[model samples]
Target: DVKVTQSSRYLVKRTGEKVFLECVQDMDHENMFWYRQDPGLGLRLIYFSYDVKMKEKGDIPEGYSVSREKKERFSLILESASTNQTSMYLCASSLVSFVMNTEAFFGQGTRLTVV
Candidate 1:
């Protein structure tokens, strides 16, 4: 089964603090993505890495960054967490061949509350 694991199910951060959320997949998928889901706005991609050490900016890359040093791991970094940044962060992974229209398996999601 394709599995994606996220570091936290919930996180609380003070405003302006740096936060890191880790994701690991055991399926050796080539496409990894970081996205934040907010009410009304839907899922907005933060970043995505197609391969190890390669990254691409998504729809909402501001205040967020990502790293993919290994094939199985992807990390999302919030440079400065703010109250406005409070949202549900979701990590997903899929085979490179299924980049379009294929369902990306997701983590349980990390609900971040920045105060």
Candidate 2:
């Protein structure tokens, strides 16, 4: 079965702490993404990498960064955590389909709270 593994199911950090959220996929998908879900705003993309060593900023990438050093792993970095950054972070991966973008398989999600 295709799988995406997130390092933590829940995380708590203080303001100004540097936080790292790790994700690994066993399916070798070409596209991986990090998104944050909040109460009213819905899911807002933070970062995405389509290939190793490549990354693109998404809608809400201000306080975040990402790394894709290998094909199966993607890491999201919160440079400095803040109260407003608390949310459910979801990691997802999908194939680079020729017809259209394939459906993404998501991890269980990491709930983060910044105090």
Best by lDDT: 2
Clashes of 2: 0
lDDT of 2 at 36: 93
Ten residues in sequence with the least summed lDDT for candidate 1: 95-104
Local accuracy of candidate 2 as per-residue lDDT tens digits, 1-115: 8999999999999999999999999998999999999989888899999999999999989989998999999999999999999899999999976368469899999999999
Per-residue lDDT over 41-82 for candidate 1, one digit per residue giving the tens place of the 0 to 100 score = 999999999999999999999998888999999999999888
Question: What residue runs in model 1 are displaced by over 4 Å at the alpha carbon?
Answer: 99-102
Q: Of the candidates shown, which would achieve the greatest TM-score relative to the real structure? A: 2
**Relative to the unseen true structure, what is the Cα RMSD of model 2?**
1.2
CA lDDT for candidate 2: 0.94
The TM-scores of all predictions, comma-separated, are 0.94, 0.95
TM-score (C-alpha, index-matched) for candidate 2: 0.95
Clash count, predicted structure 1: 0
Clashes by residue pair, model 2: none
| Global lDDT of model 1 | 0.93
Model 1: per-residue Cα lDDT at residue 79: 90
